[model samples]
Target: MKNFVFSEAVVMAGLRWTIVLIFMLFGLAKFAEYEAAGVAKIAAHYPLFAWMYPLWGESGASNVIGTIELLTGAMIAVGAFSARASFVGGLMGIFTFCVTLSFALGAPAFWEAGYGAPFLGSTGQFLVKDAVLLAACFAIMVDGLRRHTAP
Candidate 1:
């Protein structure tokens, strides 16, 4: 096996930073409620998340989820204890994507409940985006694991 070097580690850090930046920006937007109205609009398209609006309010849930996203993003970017951070972030990404997919799939049924037409298209787009993000997370996790185990 090729021995790991500092240069490889730096490259991994850069990759992690790129992923973190994207998530950070999106998370910050949600936290500031900058896209709340738009999010609320799109969210309406997916009736599956209707309960979220009622439970946390459009802005509230946005803020809470945003905060979590921001924290995780920061942790990944910093690369401090990178292995743990990568593992957590990777797991979170996978979990979030799965949950969102579940919601998206159920959206049609939710709409039949009188919520209106499902935004299956937008939901599909969201799934695609998350899948990409999940892939990035997995890559980071793998890089981190390799870095940690390297001599």
Candidate 2:
């Protein structure tokens, strides 16, 4: 059990699939009207994403994001066999998570009412988990680079 848990190959595969499934699932969700509207509300609060609403409106913006997520997931899935593919996938994943984490710019308001930090409201909980995913992206990037450059 310990060996399985600690094995580089096993751990790498686990990390790879974890990211793949998350992106895939969330990407698919974006196409739903409820999900798209919810995402729009959150994106509206972030300056960087504000332009998307004007340019694409709600569903269009959501579809754009969903496409990117699906593509990134596909790249990561292909990463299982190709270091270069994995490297690109990791880069995309890093960017994706960074953008999501940027939502933290508005995080204080996301805390449960009458409470503060350490107590998270719904949005706060959703955004904070990206930190772990961001770390995983870094790991994937580093390993991909190492493998790609190995002689």
Candidate 3:
């Protein structure tokens, strides 16, 4: 009806699709050697994923991360039809960001001066952007829950 012409649902749908597009494209890009190597530089610093460096190198580690990204994107895209998919998508979004966010702990370059200032260096600036995406994912998850539980 007229009420549906301009609505929150439409906005939520747009946000959902945006996440899908970004995640999928980045996932696909990880397959490239250059891109993977770039990630490897960072993953190398990360304790949990750094093992990828020894076990499979940048390419191998990237492939693993890429696969997960692709799956999360697909699930978010499919949130239009299934609440369960949205829930999974949201959880994945949170998981991915949490790991990336953790980089703030070990990566000194992210901190300005000696880790006391609010301002960040280039790497910190880069990683900080994920906080926004993490929030977006949380929003999507909540939206999905609202729709699913609505009477």
TM-score of each: 0.67, 0.91, 0.88
Question: How well is each residue in 25-140 modelled by candidate 3, as lDDT tens digits?
Answer: 98999899988987887887777888877888778999999999999999898887888788779888888888989888878677677665687987799899899889888888
Which numbered prediction scores highest in lDDT against the true structure?
2
In terms of TM-score, how similar is model 3 to the real structure? 0.88
Clashes of 2: 0
Give the lowest summed-lDDT range of ten residues in model 1: 106-115
**Residue pairs that clash (backbone atoms under 3 angstroms), model 2:** none
Ordered list by TM-score, greatest first? 2, 3, 1
Question: What are the runs in model 1 whose C-alpha is more than 4 Å off?
Answer: 1-7, 41-52, 107-120
How does model 3 fare in lDDT? 0.85
* lDDT (10s digit) by residue, model 1, range 1-151: 4985667657766768888887788788986656776567656456555677888898986777677678768767654466766767756655655655565555434343434554335445555566677777777767666656778
What are the lDDT scores of the predictions, listed in order? 0.66, 0.88, 0.85
* Model 2 / residue 149 / CA error / Å: 1.1
RMSD of 2: 1.8
Q: Count the backbone clashes (under 3 Å) in each candidate.
A: 0, 0, 1
